[model samples]
Target: MRSSVDKAAVKMSRRWKLICVPTVIVTVIICFTSTYLLLVKGTNRWGSGRGLRVNQNTRRTGVETTRNFSRIGNREEKTRENITKVVDREQNKILMTNSAAVAVCCTDLMNLDKDKAVIIGRRRKNKGFLTIGIPNTPRSFGKSDLKRTLKSLIQNTPNDLGQSHVSIVVFASALDQSTRLSTRDIVAGFPEHVQSGLLQLIEAPRSFYPNLSALTGSDLYNRVKQNVDNAFLLAYAMDSADFYLQLSDNVRAPSNYLQSIRDFIKQQGGAYWVTLEFYPVGFTGKLFHGGGRDMQQLIHLFTEYAREQSVESLFGHFKDLNVQLRDAVRRPPLFAS
Candidate 1:
């Protein structure tokens, strides 16, 4: 599942791309630059010292250990292959192809495939009103990462509002075989959620990513390549429901928060809107009211800025351009960290 992180590292460009891209990015970023540093600082401090937990140490130990294991496994596999090289070479073709698919599984963690995302899941037949996409990584800083986040969300949010009104997608974008299996085990604890079709664990193929080294910019926004991964979660959530709400891997909300959001959206009627902010600080508690087309527009907008700036920094610009009349009005913040 490792996607050449060493190769993904690139030196930040000294100068911005002036003539190639739109000037609006520079102009808006400059105008909104005042609060960005503070927003990030606040984002890092929320949720019982867990906050967003975007740090360089995320998954470091696990990845290094996996690499060591992979080296030993490869050497042993090579010796075994050499023994039967010519005898079973042709017969192993199908097995090798299947192995590659399983190795990548459904996760192109590096965003290697740019054109189309290959999403894999079970019981995808029933759609929902809202789909919460939690973009999760293994070996993160938080002691109570997905387990806490999923519990808060599932417990507070009702299982049935009417025929699968809501569902949770834990998009484990990056994980080694060990971590991946561990994640599945953690999620397996929620048997009712999975059996009821209220939750699903989905993954993408290796071909679904772009060249991260090309899209990357300053380290400020590219910590562990989370900016790209967050956007990946948003894009993946488009097909899951009528509305998409993004939440952090370690976040909590007040009880019945989903019902409140549903009522609020209903009260709005047919008003044109871009995004509904739930949390005051970052991208964790924002409810995006859109279907596939609406989400596609947002995915394009955010993915452009995701390379150089945090997603929270781009929210103001998105609303300004898409929903010019929308005010900064947000419902009482139910989500924390």
Candidate 2:
């Protein structure tokens, strides 16, 4: 009876142990699931932080780029303002002087505008007839031609046209340093009557049309003509002139060419245009056609080998050339007129 009682108690203890083991396993699973959920939530928050950092970095880059462009624009504007101030200052100085007559023209020479000015000599302000106008590049002349031209100019200056002043306007690129130096030397050889008017030189910092390549002769000529015309307009706004003379360094003329022109204009009631004849040093000459009316005339004259036989042909040529004053040159075209 004692042995059977002991065996029954052992069996009961084994059943209780099995039940406890299952309860412990269930608790452990709940703890592990809670930990995993917490880890996933933390990882999601970390990913959001990284995205915020990227957005901030991008915004900073954009701001920096915008600021850089603004700074550059401001710098360019300031430079242009400074240049304008300089130009105005020089113009003011010229206005203050005792200028009677003015001739406004543009050239590539650095000091052309200043050198060509006609001013009363430092000692002789009353002798207006003695005034001289020296162009930056005086036309080359043979000894005989120079003598005769000067003689005619000195003799023919009209009494009615009183003392006048001349202003040479320079339109040149600052890059042309060597040419500028040579022009200065040549201009300095003139007599004391020739004085500098506006000594300021105009230059554009960048190419006017930077996007385009400088091809085609016509395109190149237009680019140059526009800049020169701008300078001329500036001078005209400041003061009207007795006349405007067009010249170039390559167009060689007599030393007295300027004097002769001045005298001729004065004698002809100061209402005429003057231009020197030009031919290419080379056999094949490239001439300007549509740039300016004066330039077009030269082009038409050079290209049309034989004169138009009839008045109708001449008129047609004039119309084709876009000559502003349609009937100015009639009939035989007066070749040299």
Candidate 3:
């Protein structure tokens, strides 16, 4: 009886131990799984929070940077357009100003003319006239030489012409340093017949450029000629003068120059190829044949030549440097039309 009772107690104790061991193992496993799951969820939440903030910052920065660049580009484009418009406006204003100036000058010239002068075909002459008008230019020719030239012209002119038919007008200046004396003194100094032949002593402006070539190009010359022509028309009541002449202040005339020109003009009709024959100092011997015809025909010839040629070709031929004269020469005579 005691052995059976002991066996039953041992069995009961074994069963109780087995059941408690399994239950403990199950509780341990549940605790470990719950802890692991909680750790994983915390890690995931932390990573998500960091990534979201970083994405928001990146987007915000990109948008702000794009806005700044776009604003800068627009400003630069507006500045360029404004600069272009200003330049165009400036150019237009300059052009308009120049045009107005030209118109005013033209109007003044037209009103001043008495009437439109007529251009007649050249009349034939047995001998052409060389009328020298020496307007007083400052330091144009030396004092002694100028007087000598004038004296020579007076002396030689009488000897050449059978009668005093040579026309001369000494355009003097009261202000000229060289000619302190009146035009009367200068005229009185000439031979009686030559003095008698003196057409007129027109007092001119002191600062007139005495160079014939320079006068040919100047507006002053044109203005003077127009006034002179008007005066001539008023004096003689005629449209045009029959002849034109050129004179040098410093050059002395040869005794036979007039006679030679007369004979040449007689033979050649309206146009004669006349040139100035130079003599060396103190010698009075032949130097060379230089000078040209009247300004009108020369201008005519140049105009005709230009019609068949270009500016380059014509300038290349003469090699002269007078740009205004070249342009005027290359065109038809203003007086001719």
Best by TM-score: 1
Tell me the tens digit of each residue's lDDT in model 3 across 174-227. 344446454446555655544354333444332222233455544445433433
- Evaluated against the true structure, the overall lDDT of model 2 is 0.32
Instruction: Flag clash pairs in model 2.
Output: 113-168, 114-196, 118-166, 139-253, 140-253
Global lDDT of each candidate: 0.57, 0.32, 0.36
Clash counts for all predictions? 9, 5, 3
Model 3: residue 130 alpha-carbon error in angstroms: 4.4
The best-first sequence of candidates by lDDT reads 1, 3, 2
Residue 68, model 1, lDDT = 14
TM-score of 1: 0.57
Candidate 2 C-alpha lDDT tens digits along 180-279: 4554443344333123221222333343322323445644443443333333323321222434433332333343444555454355342222221122
Candidate 1: stretches off by over 4 Å: 1-123, 138-144, 211-224, 328-331
For candidate 3, give the lDDT of residue 326: 15
Tell me each candidate's TM-score: 0.57, 0.28, 0.33
Candidate numbers sorted by TM-score from highest down: 1, 3, 2
Error of 3 at 299 (Å): 12
